[model samples]
Target: MSVWLPTAPCTPRDCAGHLGARRAPLPAAVLLTAGCALTLLGVACVPAVLLLGPAHRDRLIRGWAYAVVRAFGVRVRVTGVTAGEGRSPVGELVVANHVSWLDIPLVATVLPARMLAKSEIRTWPLLGPLAALGGTLFIERDRLRALPGAVRALAGALASGSRVAVFPQGSTWCGRSGGGRFRHAAFQAAVDAGAVVRPVRIRYLTAELHPAGAAAFVGEDPLAASLWRVVTAAGLTAEIRVLPPIPAGSEPDRRALARAAQSAVASDSANRPAESVHH
Candidate 1:
């Protein structure tokens, strides 16, 4: 199958259409095989590092997963992760806005973090296995009685020296429109655990280059096609900004803390001009 390469000297705006028109169907067999191979590689490494235990093992799995995604053609660019005052010795909670499924590997690549994911992901075919290996904590929103235990588990992970990554927005968006309203539960979790909340902003630079909502895996947009669109498109960039940490003592209430973090991320995202296009 012929792989379409966008022509040289093309503007970001024209690149997507040019590439999409010429896109040959990506081989399902190849994509599946590659994903399986990468996942197995991650699983294999787990037993060897038993001495380092769960925390370090989780980090290793996350690193392998990120490498797999990059090898499969997604390019991730991160900023502000290393900037801030740095995390405390007792671990921290990373609160960020969710944008895409890509955010999983994207955040993993930057931080040795564990995420609070929805329960549905635990049953996804290949992704489910990979996420399980990566130590993702799945939450069943409808199970009210189990929520306290879940929150306690999150606190335990932080106490044990693992950075927990949570999408406070609770849902994804195109970033042009606002993301979903921030959920205060994760912030409360942070406060209850006495962990610092590190806010992050994630933005995908694909709107000007690809179809609106092209990266989303909905309707006609299958996962493989979305992956192809992101990989082959010129000027495709996913920017993540990790802002300063907000100590638990700084905010009087969890809701206020959540709002402050959301505002910080939104403000930072708004200031950045959408002009970084790779030719």
Candidate 2:
């Protein structure tokens, strides 16, 4: 298989079990409707929002992302070291593990950047148009020959002072683990652009703060099913851990850099004092 098309062992039947009793059906219905409405509202506003200045656009995107997650009744808790600390304002490669469709907006809440998404997403209903308008970089995962051009496009974006967010794992995994590991291809873009890597780890939790699996969008899981699971799961919390930034040129090659970033993400750093936190 092509590196861009790596698969994960996680399946919905095995890795995405419900954690507890879900929200009352009535409340869940309200959340579901509200979430969809908020998403469509954002899509409708994308064209107008893009017309604003970069700073204004970013703030709007961040706020919109946070609102979308919140609308689904999933509270976001961000912790760990600050992502942009001591780094250049632009050109940082924000990398994270994939868990659900929710990962896109969740990452945007903290690190709003040009997203790197699979070409398949370009055809996905309202999200497709929204992502395109948001300047997402799409990769043709099935076409190995297209890898060079994709990397070049990503590098060009980063080199042009644009922060880019990429899920280097290529595919979403169970939030707990088993996504095969980060592919080095995206890391090459960072290296080429001389960009710092901001590694982030995301987890879903119950109201009591224990691990929750209902949010994982794994094998054979339809988007509707995943979205329903999120909206109905009362008090589902997405805890985003932004690990320390890996300095530019810190690794000799993409492979080493990929490994370094993955190590930081996979490490058990929960007990370590977080540099900051945001609700």
Candidate 3:
């Protein structure tokens, strides 16, 4: 199997169950409407935002992302970001485990970087144009012949001091039952560009900090269904843990580097709750 198209065993029926106390229907509807409205507003403003200097543009993007998540009624808790880590000038390959559609905005809140998206997202209804306007790098994950070109594109972006956020897991998981392994393909770009690898860990939890499935968007889970689940799930919180970066040349090859990054992600914050700064 092509590492770029790795499969996960997680299914909506089995792993994406509602595990949290749900909000009343009216509140959920309001949250959903607000979230959708904010997302569309961001899309409409993308053109103007792009005209600003990079620093100003990124600040707006970060704020917009946080607002969108809040509109969905999901609290965000982020930890482990050191001083200047989020605003570093050095090019970095920001890799994370995929769990839900929310993962995109969640990551953007802390690291407003160029997203590495599956090419299919380019054709999505509203998100497609927004992603393009936001400078997302689309990769044809199913086409093995496209791997080299994708790698080159990623490397080119990183070599130019651009932070590129990627979900190296290839597919979303429940974030509880050992997620899929981090495929080595994307790590190749970091190695080629001599960029540092920043591994991030994301988890969805209920108010009591128990692992939550309501936010999972795994196999055959429709996007609308996932959104509804998230908005209605009472007191659900997304936890983002930014682990230490692995310097360039720390590993001799991409495989070793991927393994090292994966090890850090899997071991650093598994089930251990750090003091979080909520946004």
Candidate 4:
């Protein structure tokens, strides 16, 4: 079992001043053991899919993943999921604020969706296999040559009755302190596909589990320890607020639609802090 260290430089000022005391490193043995077990279990499910077909297998994998996270003590509470109404039957893109790496599994619990993942994730040891099985679409954000094909693939997925999830900010942040500006490529793809854009706001109610902006890999904060932090907090609530879906033609251009969606999420995040409900 390997214990991963935090990648971001933690100066005495950053850690000692604001963030709470740096506790002893978490128990790596338990964390890695559980991670390996879950990975193996996920791998085992691949062959079983031959008997269960693609759709059923996907649901099973998603359920298993969600259960694993919860079992590790990450209690995810969702609100405003009802905002997805009238956006179903496919042809829709769900754009949300990226907070933690946990957002992937958390979102999966609510929507049967495929994600637009960073291309580098395609090579992740255990996660890569599971993501491929779940039909995630990988894109190279820095490679302009690859953007066209990636957009086309996303558009096709939406048209074929698959809801695609994109974190338009293009990076993760600690939602409590706010986030960076969102990129508009995902919105452009939505427009091209004639898909409704569903803006979602994700909030991490707990402190310890909140992401440190510069962490290169999230594994540094052992998954179990972070999950425990979320679970045992006064109240554990990771909110997902899905705002009303904006129709493709509702705005004059993609940029306007993107701004509208961003504004919706920002407003929801502000007005409804306790309950992650979207208007």
- Alpha-carbon local distance difference test for all models: 0.63, 0.84, 0.87, 0.63
Q: How many clashes (backbone N, Cα, C below 3 Å) per candidate? A: 0, 0, 0, 0
How big is the positional error of residue 12 in model 3, measured in Å on the Cα after superposition?
A: 0.9
Write one digit per residue (lDDT tens) for candidate 2, span 127-220: 8888988899998899999999999999999889888899998888987754568999889989999988999888888878777888999888
Clashing pairs in 2: none
Residue 188 in candidate 3 has what lDDT?
90
How many angstroms is residue 91 displaced in model 1 relative to the true structure, after the best TM-score fit?
2.4
Residue-level lDDT for 250 in candidate 3: 90
**What global local distance difference test value does model 3 have?**
0.87
TM-score of 2: 0.94
Candidate 3 stretches greater than 4 Å from native: 82-86, 270-274
Summarize candidate 3's per-residue lDDT along 29-147 as a digit string, tens digits.
99999999999998999989989987788788888998999999999888887324455556799999899988989998888888999998998766788899899999988899999
TM-score against truth, every candidate: 0.75, 0.94, 0.95, 0.74
Q: Is candidate 1 or candidate 2 better by lDDT?
A: 2
Candidate 2 global lDDT: 0.84
Query: Of 3 and 4, which scores higher on TM-score?
Result: 3
- Give every collision pair in model 3: none
